[model samples]
Target chain A: MAEINLTINTQLAREILTGFIQSEITRVGFSRAVVGLSGGIDSALSCVLAAQALGPENVLAVRMPYKASSRDSLDHAQLLIDQLGVQSKTIEVTDMVEPLIQLDPDMSKVRKGNLMARARMIVLYDQSEAFKGLVVGTSNKTEILLGYSTMFGDSASAINPIGDLYKTQVRQLSRALNIPAPIVDKPPSADLWAGQTDEDELGFTYEEADKLLYLLVDQRYMPQEAIEAGFDERFVNTVVARVRRFQFKRMLPPIAKISNRTIGYDFLYLRDWGT
Target chain B: MRLQLALAQINTKLGDVQANLDKHLGLIDKAKKQKTDLLVFPELSLTGYVLQDLVSYVAHRPTEEDPVFKPLLAASHDLDLVVGFVDEDSRHRFFIASAYLSGGKVLHVHHKVYLPTYGLFDEGRFFAWGDSVKAFDTRFGRMGMLICEDFWHASPPYLLWLDGADIMLFSSASPGRGLGDNEKLESARWVERINMAYASMFTSFVAHANRVGYEDGLHFWGGTTVFDPNGEELAHGPYNEEALTYAELDLNQLRRTRARLPLLRDERTGLVRSELDRILSRG
Candidate 1:
């Protein structure tokens, strides 16, 4: 009750994020960033921020499309690329993934989507090497908490700028940054299959999810607290369960502690790894 | 007299003295515009907490003769200020110290008495421990100053109370910690409660200023606040945000509470001294 509303100053957030990106990149001896732009608000915001931090000349926005992907996805991504004047590339993943799909022959849609997601990461890491840039993440906190992202796929990146912003806050910052109205207003989708939208698959709107997530995660509310706060009992249970279940995705691979100095247990930092 | 006090809870970059000094000046000006009598900042506000080995780089003598603190001296000409900094004494030894300044001169300096070395704090590694706690006369009556960890001990506040100090200012850089069943930061909650308890027990006004923002993964929760003599909050800043919260302290409330409770009227120092002597002799 003592804490105030979960509102952030957009101007301050922008400055801090841009500075974080610049510092993290230069710290690891990198000067540029490569972002996988999906024409979604999250990716668009990341691309714009990276362009602002490292300059448009140093940002490379890659758009990886599937066979059934929407043409609007590409067009919307192009809108950002053109507006920002950053480098861009469109890579078709149908050929790369077709062999894996053929090997399974009757692969489910879920498997096929996961394949496409990881395929995009492959191209991203490859571009990171070719362009001498680090892969910047675009996963918002909502998707991350809900386990809505593909692991080792869209989630794999050297650093993430918008990972802490909730889906609603991401939209809020997108508006503040003047991202194209079409991209911001469009229904969220992963473009894995025809007519595939995020909320439709998740069975809830982002506004509903973000509010619930803010209370559950950022505020560290228990289920009863959320229930008292007017969140639906079933919805809170489901989201909280999903967050617990997907907690593994948020952490690195756990190592078995056998030695006095295991990698992650006691000997954690780089300096601890004996020079 | 009603004293207008402003607690400037700000985010400071580690070891960035020049930038941090500018931040202090900016907040000082803002407080002056509001006609505040006293402005207090967080512990080591001129050099952010978690300096590690950078303490040497940022440590500077806080005197008008020192160029680093010249601007702050000028800014304190109108408003009385309590600013924390790394103090290098005549012997060139560094101590975590807070200066009480008014009319462009450093009035009194309170070196941090308790150097917290456990857990995340390693102040003993860098700062020399202060040996005493004292109160001094200010325009707003006698007041005492304590650094972050000094509040955790009962002796400091008790000594100040015995010295007849009416107001106590505590500057802190406490990191945000675990959440209780109430779903709020337990550390911040405890800090507020203990501050109220101290204010009520000692029958004095209590004002605490804490820093906010992330530094090397440790996040300082800024819940800067002021409490009246009766343990009621006068002003509370939002948690984890940069703010300059203000409150008017009525010293008459302290007198009224003291008259009602009369706890400090009884003499107990002789008993305390005898018990301490006996305990130490057994050791």
Candidate 2:
């Protein structure tokens, strides 16, 4: 089997990512960032980058936890906050999510998790207004491609600093940035429900998933070609199916073409676009 | 005399003239600190490459009084600068051009002689080609400028050499192409070979400054470099990254090479011109 090497120069990555954050934020007439610290490697990496880009004083790391959340989650997040010397705030979503959870006598684990995700976003957005900072996102490319995040919830953000990085790349950067080893080594999880892990839900490991996805997406391999590339046919099809099904999550809501210049169609105006 | 040359390999955003000018100033400051005699920037360093329809919007005349370029002029008072930009003449005819600047004034402006139209390049569609190639005297020596495609043709460099150019600067925005056996990118390798041959044949110093960064899937390979009169690689910058590469040239070396070979002195220019005229008369 051909080996897929996705190694990156972490130092260059750090410099470019930090420079991108600083320039992008400053260009939009703001200099502050509010990142949701979920105690995961992705969010931890983003928080450290934000702190470095906009001074530690300007970055606000908000930790939103639920009732059934792991104790290690808050402790791990606090370790990063103290290490980076950025401002931190803790908000419990148990009260905000209870009324919605009560709307259904028997809410499924997925619905409850979605509710928690949206509740966290609400808190972050509120804090953004109060803190006068943009909300930097934490979703990595792997989860984003598979639609593992909730739309209008964790997926909504002003800008994302690490969205282009895959899950394994995030772990590599986390280790390079001196993230707490315990946090970096821990099994990946969203902490949405009691005892729920990401690999358990996805039925695959991130390392294997990253290689397969890199070939399928970046190398532009067909399903048969990917299967020949050592990926099981079923696994390849499942991942490809998920990526295709979740394409809507990657873009803004499609606007119907009523006129020649629809909002996102012919009239493409990015933040940097000018007359 | 020893001349210090700095190649400012930068990443320029498309259609952002003011921002690119700001980036140039920052690099110029670094070059000044290095005590560089001449600083070279990439092709379209001010407005960037890959402007399909936005070309006209960013095109500006190269003049000292232009308000947008005032700071660049002030920065050039201390060091000579070779920078690329969209050149619009007084008649509103736009061309891909490189300007040689020193002491708050433009010494010479060379419009690109060749407008590549094949494959990924569509320069012929947007720009009018330049009519002439000439070398002008500078503080360093007799210098000439060429935008990216101009250097690809053999005749342009030969014309400059015949015009008594001691140093030829080629500003480029070459996209990264094929990969080699060692897994390293070999996109700019072809250009490097051509540059080496040009310097060796003309016995003149050759410097190339290329931009880095991705623009709409086109990744520019930034292997900026300088080759001495004998085709020796003096200084080179990293590929796929922004950097400032510097090299020191000994003007006496060119004179020594010319004295030993004297190839320029034996050129049959009169015979070639007469044969060309005879052929044209027959037609």
Residue range with the least summed lDDT across 10 consecutive positions in model 2 chain A: A266-275
Considering only N, C-alpha and C atoms within 3 Å, which residue pairs clash in candidate 1? none
Question: Which digits, one per residue and each the tens of the lDDT, describe model 1 over residues A166-274?
Answer: 8877888888888999999999998899899999999999888888887777677888998888888998898888899999999989998888877666442321011
Task: Give the alpha carbon lDDT tens digit for every residue of B1-283 in model 1.
Answer: 7899999999886677888888999999999999999999999898888775666777888788887678888888889999989987788788899999888888889999999998767789778888889999988899999987899898899899898788999999997654323434667888888899989888789999999865643567788988888888999997767999999998899879888888778749888889989999996
**What is the fnat score of candidate 2?**
0.00
Q: Please, what is the TM-score per model?
A: 0.61, 0.75
Backbone clash pairs for candidate 2 read none
lDDT string for model 2 (B1-283, tens) is 9998999899887788988888999999999999998999999999888775667888887787786567777888989898889988878888888988899988999999999998778788778888999999998789888888888889899889889898999999987644323334455768888999998888889999999865643567788889988888988898767899988988898888888877778878898789989998996
iRMSD, per candidate, in listed order: 9.6, 5.8
lDDT of 2 by residue, A1-275 (tens): 68887676577567657766776677667989999999988899999999988999999999999999999999999999999999999999999999988999799999999999999999999999999899998999899999999998989788787887788888888899999997899999999987889999999998888999988877778889989988888888899999999999998899889986777765533354431
